[model samples]
Target: MTSPLDSRQILRRQLRQARKNLSNHAQLIAAQTLVARVDHYLSGQQTDKLKKVALYLANDGEISPHLLCEYFWQQSIATYLPVIQGKQLGFARYTADSMWQENSYGIKEPVTADYAPSRDLDLVFLPLVGFDSQGGRLGMGGGFYDRTFANKRPDASPQLIGLAHECQQVKSLPVESWDVPLQAIITPQQSILVS
Candidate 1:
């Protein structure tokens, strides 16, 4: 029998591999479809005050949000990428001409001194290894997003949304004490609003 922590680890590994197995063409289609789904979801919400938004560059098999970034750019909404600031995440504005530096994990981060804390952003789209319909998210086990947004509530200003491939959906996930609940989860096929 697997303990809850062990179960989570197993689920993480399985889901990570499931997504990682997607062909490059399939991944491209999923990303393109995601932009439409995300746009539709946001259109039905009150996004009048959205200014700064946070999203991640796709790593591993995480669905890319580059197209969604372009959608935001067209609307004049600034996008940011997470910078590893100690144990938590600091968001740096990402622009077409932004310079880059590699983080410890070899992920490229925007080379900028102007880092914004989580509270200032209007919306945040997170990358996940697995997610449940009830807003449970299994991250890369780094806990960066959890630590960065731990103090925020579901109805907080920076609405947390997890983005994933359809293959990453699970029946449920073991919720830990430190796990921060997402306000919603978005995939190429569906958008789940956590109530």
Candidate 2:
């Protein structure tokens, strides 16, 4: 019998293959599914009061959240994005009309002047390369998000949520001590909430 670790490795390889096989239309459909799942979760009583939310600008095989951003902005919720600084990310307010410049990774980020350190966010939507039912996440091999969340004070920890397609789910993922677990993970199939 294969161990869980071995099963995870096999699953990761298959997940990668599936991602590579996804057509643009299929990906778009998957993105919309996950977006709807997240919207449902946000509409729930537990999350309805959250006024400040952070989200990522999708790229490549990642599920797009552009529509989600637009909907949130339209609802007058405060939207924020992560600004890469060295090896960590700083949060900055974002809107449909917010000016953005391409970062080193070619990802769009809010202009530096739009950054406000005093802002306290209620939720953060994290992008993941892979994730598991246990809330373990595999990032883009960069420890940026992990390090950023690691720096957060205990009292200031934001509600960390991961956005990914159902294909990105694995049986398990390698995790380090400093890697913060997600509070919830939203996928095309369902939302896994971790306590």
Candidate 2's clash total is 0
Question: What ranges in model 1 sit over 4 Å off?
Answer: none
lDDT of 2 at 103: 89
Top TM-score hit: 1
Q: List lDDT for all candidates, in order.
A: 0.91, 0.77
**What lDDT tens digits, residue by residue, belong to model 2 across residues 61-162?**
777777778778777888888999898888888865788899888998998466635237788888877888988887765688888777665446477888
Per-residue CA lDDT of model 1 for 6-81, tens digit only, reads: 8888888999999999999999999999999998998987777789999999999899999999999999998999
lDDT of 1 at 57: 96
lDDT of 2 at 162: 87
Worst 10 residues of 2 by lDDT: 112-121
TM-scores vs. true structure, each candidate: 0.96, 0.84
Candidate 2 ranges with C-alpha deviation above 4 Å: 1-17, 46-48, 116-119, 153-157
